[model samples]
Target: MNDDQATPNPTKDRKFVEALSRGLDVLRAFSQGSVVLGNQDISRITGLPKPTVSRMTYTLTKLGYLAYSPQLEKYQLDSGVLALGYAYVSNLRVRQLAKPYLDEFARNTNTSVGLTCRDRLSMIYVENCRPAEITSLRMDVGVRLPLATTAAGRAYLAAMKEEERRHVMSSLAERHPDTWPELKQQLEESFRDYEKYGFCLSLGDWDRNVNAAGVALHLQDGTLMALTCGAPTYLVSEEKVKNQLAHQLAILARDIERLGV
Candidate 1:
């Protein structure tokens, strides 16, 4: 499973560039919490050889994607990565279109609203809004959530095609083998929620005192995204999440698809 392992069989797929994949994996080793790292840290995180990691860091630094810090003896992501992230998020037409509505909804409901899409085995927030009067979930853009845990993630899975859902579930199971049975049961229940309620609910399942409801949007070009409405348990009643907010979110999603260019 290590990147240094010779049989990186996924590379056998057509047009799957192994070296590029490995380099990207190296870049991904850096996160918000992991601000600076050396070859050994990246090697340990990525399961690639130290020498390979060294070479990757050198190449990435040369390409302006990473900066070498002689003082710290580590690497930090450079402007290249920032530019890429900024450019991608800025150009998301759906996020742009949904912003006003999402902001208004958040303000009116005194909750947090987020739009997210799948990233690997998780959902990455593309846009998020919160009420100015209340501080709810502090999750922001780029925050990732487990694909089976959050209401947004469950709504996303419920919206996927059957075969694709099976593939994703298989991946999730592999990623969490021991907990798969419990999580799978939760997903089945959430799917039923989606069918009956027009949205999915995560009733403090992701945390001890959080409640959330989510609806999925399938865009004209087939881009799938999920919109989530969430708040602290004390702030939002489960009855409101199940009966009111969830359905309201579903209507908002439909409006976004119908009206957005």
Candidate 2:
């Protein structure tokens, strides 16, 4: 199932193991720059009790998912964590199936093209194709952009069923309580544009220097994915993105959907 789809709360589900969830949360507290984290740091980030954080850290460290640093008194993610992500990607063949078409599209548009899917509150890039020349947005596999602000994410939201879209919006509201009002308005506009153009545009919304447009499609296995192409704001104007690139992205989405992979 798409990770974006809401699952039953582990806290309320009798069969759910809350400990596992907490352990994962502790690991997630570490990001690209914040690689090493102490128990108190994790507690503050995850809002878990200090004692619980200690226990989870110790358990994860013993399981090889986290490695404790003796000199710094902090924990860092170990290579074992990559195995989990690798397992997930190895099972999803979309990247392999979409690479050639994405490559051609990137070359034709002289922009950066990416294939991404909804992952919790963000869109995670699974495949990226770049033209020979350098581009403004430098994204690789595993890069994540906020779902409420990115073109790929907006397209994904626009393509979802109304009930699913509402559920996702409510979750976004809770996660970003302060920015939800403005984000909601932006998303409403995107939905209207999608209805008229078959795609959505994000013009310097996520990043001031970059502009992207995207279209979403469902694969043969019923997995929802988005195709996005982006370049520097000066190079790719909103008019060009909406009139030219958006149609190309929509055609690529349809081609991938026809692949039935």
lDDT of 2 by residue, 1-261 (tens): 113335568768889987887787787777524889999898988788999999999999899999999999999999789898888777778888889999999889988999998877789888899976845578988888888899999999999999889999988888777888998999999999999999998998999888899888788777888888999987778888888999989999999888878
Error of 2 at 145 (Å): 0.5
RMSD to the hidden true structure, all candidates? 2.8, 2.8
| Count of residue pairs whose backbone atoms collide, per candidate | 0, 0
Report, for every candidate in turn, its global Cα lDDT versus the true structure: 0.86, 0.86
Give the Å shift of residue 167 in candidate 1.
Answer: 1.9
The residue pairs in collision within model 2 are none
Cα shift from native, residue 171, model 1 (Å) = 1.9
Name the Cα RMSD for model 1: 2.8
C-alpha lDDT (0 to 100) for residue 54 of candidate 1: 92
**Against the true structure, what is each candidate's TM-score?**
0.91, 0.93
